[model samples]
Target: MSVRGRRASFISAGVRFIVILGLSVASCWPFRQSQDIEFTFLLPPGRVECFYQPVAKNGSMEVEYQVIAGAGMDVDFTIVSPHGYLLTSDFRKSDGIHTVEPTEEGDYRICFDNSFSRVSEKMVFFEVILDGQGAEGGGDDEWADMVEPESMLEYKLEDIRESVESVHRRLERSRQMQTLLRAFEARDRNLLEDNLWRVSFWSCVSLLVMLGVALTQVYTLRSLFHDKRRVHT
Candidate 1:
């Protein structure tokens, strides 16, 4: 081939290669989903509820809970490991988070206790997230077979996804915190109402007692001061 013709051929081949690589990346984009679940339930007085969550060894399990409504807006919480060891114990807590790294590969128990409550049913909100460390980097070697630029782009995309996921998680945490604040406000309001009612009731009782004493003394004094007109006619 002549020099000018060879240059034109090389340019066309480069353009074709760029387009093919773009299409390939577009066709096989990688995405992984993290596990997260939330639940809300009513816990009746004097009852205990337990949930079993399966986690692999070295994996992390995160749990968060809030008591939205009840007499004291609190409940007893416990976490038990698969090997029958106590992992966490919270007594009459309103809201909190607990994270555990499992040493045994089996089901872990999470229990909510309303046994100390006798009058009110509790509304509990809980979230469970499993951080699967075992799956990370399991597929990275496949990217090594690709060209360096392609591999770098893929990793960057993965990092972007991670950042987006992190933002989403923060938003969720904010929402949960707002809910917890509202619940606390409600509990305070209820306590204020009960106190007001008690004060009013006691005031009324005191007023009635004072009135009775006053009337009784007045009648006794009038009877003692009666004129001596027993034998007029």
Candidate 2:
């Protein structure tokens, strides 16, 4: 083969490798073991909210929750199995994490109860993670079709797969960290707002009290001066 033609062929092969790698990564995204559902909601006083997640037999589920903003920053949390069996329960907690390994395939119920807090509504953040249930498959056949068995690229498939999985795990960790950080930020913001209001209110009250004391002193001094003048006259 001519030098130019060989170079062109090399470039084409590289391009194909990159394209196939990208497609394989994209195809694997939907098959991640840990699928997460996250939500933030306002739970009014004396109200309860429940959510359901379906899990396959032998699958695992996790629930994490935080009370980001509210009067007491606490709520009652509960998890129930599909067979009406209570799996977990926490009373008046500000944050919690629970995990369940189900023996039966069905929907599990997760609930947040605010009935104990009759006057203050709560802002709740929660995440549900379903694991051990992803479909098992890969794009190995696609890679095989694009690359010859004798080619050097075929030898690197295992390495490529490992790298993709590592990257995916890192992304999942990053996502979870971001979620927790957001919840912390929201709680901090609420605390700052509350402190600001309390400070402003007390400052105003102090100012009013100081003014009242000054006025009272002025009035007493003037009355005494008038009495002294009358006595001298």
Top candidate by TM-score: 2
Instruction: Record all residue pairs in model 2 with backbone atoms less than 3 Å apart, i.e. clashing.
Output: none
* Candidate 1 least-lDDT 10 residues: 151-160
Cα lDDT over the full model 2: 0.83
TM-score of 2: 0.78
Worst 10 residues of 2 by lDDT: 146-155
What is the per-residue lDDT of model 1 for residues 100-147, given as tens digits with 9 covering 90 to 100?
864468999999999998888998888887865454444445455544
> Distance from true position, residue 79, model 1, in Å?
0.6
Question: What's the lDDT for all of these models?
Answer: 0.76, 0.83
Per-candidate TM vs. native? 0.59, 0.78
